[model samples]
Target: MTVRRPIQRFYTEPAPMNKLGKPHLQVVRSISVGQAPNIPDTDGVNEMLAKAGPSATLKDVARGILDRLVERPELEVQVEEILFLKDCLGASLEWLCSLAASDGAACFKRPLLWSGWCSRCDCEAKDYLMIYTKQVNANSCPGTPGSRSRTPSVAFSRPPSWESLDANILEDFDKWDFDSFQLSEATKGSPLHFAGWKALGGFLGEEPSDVFLEMERTSRFLEAVEDMYARQDTVLYHNNVHAADVTQCVHALLLQFGFAAYFDQLSILALLLGAIVHDMGHDGRTNSYHANVCDDIALTYNDISVLENMHISKTFKLMHSDPSTNILEGFKLEHRNRLRKEMVEVVLGTDMSSHFGNVADFKTLIEKLGSDPAEWHHEPKAMSALRVMVLHAMDISNPAKVLPLSDKWSDLLRQEFFLQGDEEKRLGLPISPLCDRETVRFASSQVGFFTIIVQPTFTLMAELQHRVKDVLLTHLQTNTEAWEARKRKEQLGLEISQALPLLKIRPLESTELTDLAVFPDTGACLFSPSRGGSTRDVPCDSQSHGQPRVPAVQRNVEDVEGSDDETALAALAALACCASVEAQVAKGFHKNRPAAPAEAFALFY
Candidate 1:
């Protein structure tokens, strides 16, 4: 049977020299020529090209062509023509020279050609093409006598071995200082990339070559993640550092809890990858905020785990667009499909809305296992549940960390919330609770969150893993205590401010105390002048009489007594003594001076 191959029809026209003084071939129009029976599915190929757009550079076209050729090897001739045209258009020889230099022995090897449709434009408009020398042994290269081909420096040369990632290291995850393992020079300020690469490579037990390849791919992916996040309107709480923290936590959980045994290499890969990209492309806003405002992402996901869905979709889209960063490119079709499904579900589970549900599911799974580790170990459903639950736990595990780390994350989260609150206020929207800086009490909110959400979750996890119970519970207890102490201090300060008036009193000018009358109803002090011996009233309201009414001080004292705070009592006592001495001095002065007319009387200090 004669099968027709897919044809890409392109209407090419001569264009003026580009800025680089090179002849440019403008693609006027493009259309799909035809589909060949022998051709494989070209959707992935087309998608990659489309991402590059219609006005792609020669380098872009070359990459697209190579990607398509990897999937469909039957389109050689058409690809050759595209390459020839690219060369005629003054395509740089730098890439070819670099390849030749690197493959010193294979410089004279016969060039391999491949062709496919340019997925960006209509099938007829642009053809994908590339030409490369076949792989050859470096030892066979005819270089200068005695000259040697330099070997490329390998990242993760001393990656952690699977055997070393056992219980001890897993338990040390909380104590692990990720920055200490960073290759600052290689990662270019992205220590997390190196850390993730080491952890992933170690967990998979990959050989040096395989580990190096995967590391390169993962590094590229991490770079892409960094770039995507850099472009996002993200806050400090959901940035790259937080994502890396979560990823490390997830890795630790898998190893620490012995959950690594249940997951295959592919599953572990997906879990680690999911953790790294779970919060990608965050817009520094909550899902509720997005849904309430009808944001584009909310509408796209129909308000169903909007932020999570966006993160997963954006991550996958980025992976598909860039071959260098497509870490799953080597996976089999079924493995890749499973990876995508697992990654999506796990990442979505990171959303706080699903937290309770995940915890509930974990509990149910544990109940089903019923003290039998053997039964749970091989059960796929249980393992899957554990996988997601672990990720969920890690996502909210900031409070489960040691004091200093926990405090840092808490402050960052509060800052993000306050920023959102400011925006809401500006937009005339009702601010969300724990977001409004004017009203939200940070210590109180954290206390409630720990008591209500974090403590219970970690407690459940601890119950499942008796060995880790102390570690989890200890941190939770310390953090709870810290917040509680803060709450109490804040309350005490508030009471002290209210009680200040109790100690501020004015002394009566007359030595005779029998006429002293306190009017509780009117909060006034009645005094009789020594000269006329007539009673006169002074209001305690500071605004009205330039002096506080005596009744307000009594009220403040009553409040202080009701509080039953020893500190408050001591403060009140000291203030009362000061007030008594001032009054005595004033009375002595008034008695020493002759009594004046009532109209001329003045209140003493």
Candidate 2:
């Protein structure tokens, strides 16, 4: 039977009830549209919003809906009702309706759900909706493009096989524009920016002119690094896109937390500029790669994380190569040294081997800051400590950002390292434990590395730098949990379970339309169901008007027939796992990629 799904669209509808029991009708639009007209352009919502004042519930709903969906459209499907409510009630209500709308707005709009309510409560339905909305928002936040739970890149093919995802990573490497980045984007001219801008102005000790120029210089450096980092072989699994993401995160932290006032323009510029270049010469091999076979780049830096340090120095040198591009040229000699030292400290801090000593020193400094908030001075040591802590945390911040993202990164790095180990085997070289191609359960060691090395380091730094406290703490908690959780899974033999396929997917790559996942356990290959199907088993039924519900059953390929049970189930499970992983990776990739016209969402019928 052909079932017509409601086409997501915008329309003028009856005003929803406001808190004041006032009549309000609003123009409701499905968020799938590419560009949203001004709320004022919507039928009657803006008129009341203006009359109600900015603090009015109607205003908040109108403003919040527009702001939330500006970057993400998938959210509309999840919160269509809330958007609809805002469209209708925002025009006439002043109190209860507004309050309910605000609660929904906050509950549904967070990046992730942090709490859950009792399942049996009368309001449980609303609570569950909120929880579900939180998950949807978290899974669908702006920074993470395709991640449902921040898993690494995975791929699925009609017949799955291993393929390198380097190209896919490169394509998405271009999307991040340094200058356009914001810490807290409330509205176009919101009070958030005004305060941040003022803080930055004060921090720089110069008015807008000099500070803006310095930012421009910083942006140029970031752009160049993006270009260089995107080249083949520079990044293996953790590539330029990862660099861009971390940079953006750091940039956002600086703006969001109002750190701009504490440090000077040189300091801010150094942190940002250094971030772009820090990983430029990374070869996917750990620092141990320094001791192996006199790597060409290693030879140049005398094996002291020479590649990273050189990346910093080379980036600056390149900047100075062209007079027009020379950001340091305009600075006074003392200022140049200050900028150089700050940049050096930040870039050098990326070395994971020295993370303990570095973060410890930073923690000591934070301890020294003590209870006096005003005693802070602009000393090189002070700036260096703060800058290093931020860059260091950023370098290792991936796992802490989200458990799935961290685990995925660890998986990819392990894969790439082992791939290198495979090359070693082919070349008659000794295989390293984590790096050896012959190694099975390679992820085991990475879990340890994350626990012992990566986790503690970032946790300490987060304690020191409040700017990324939320981001860092989240990562740390998630990292520990992921490790513990993965261990539990390993104990259950779930790690080796063939419930999911092992697909090698890349970020930001166009997937072939014909490829689909097939689960071996259930013999259920992916069938693109165009219409809603329901069963009594699901408590909250999303039922269509006239369709009869199908009874729940356990069968092999009953829905999509003509496929063998074992083969199809294996294929389906493998494909599903791969697809899940791929979707997560795609989000990160696209987020890092240069902005282009949005890719048309692929639909299955």
Candidate number with greatest TM-score: 1
- Candidate 1 C-alpha lDDT tens digits along 474-532: 88899999999777655544444444454455554356332443323223333333333
Off by over 4 Å in 1: 1-188, 203-213, 230-234, 371-374, 377-379, 493-566, 569-605
| Whole-model Cα lDDT of every candidate shown, in order | 0.54, 0.44
Model 1 clashes, total count: 10
Name the TM-score of candidate 1: 0.56
lDDT of model 1 at residue 83? Answer: 25
Cα deviation in Å at residue 443, candidate 1? 0.9
- lDDT per residue (tens digit) for residues 245-338 in model 2: 5665565556444444455546676776676667765666665555575777678778887767767877777877855445565566786787
Clashing pairs in 1: 9-124, 30-125, 31-124, 31-125, 32-124, 46-119, 50-120, 105-141, 540-548, 540-549
Error of 1 at 143 (Å): 24
Using all chains and alpha carbons, the TM-scores for the candidates as numbered come to 0.56, 0.47
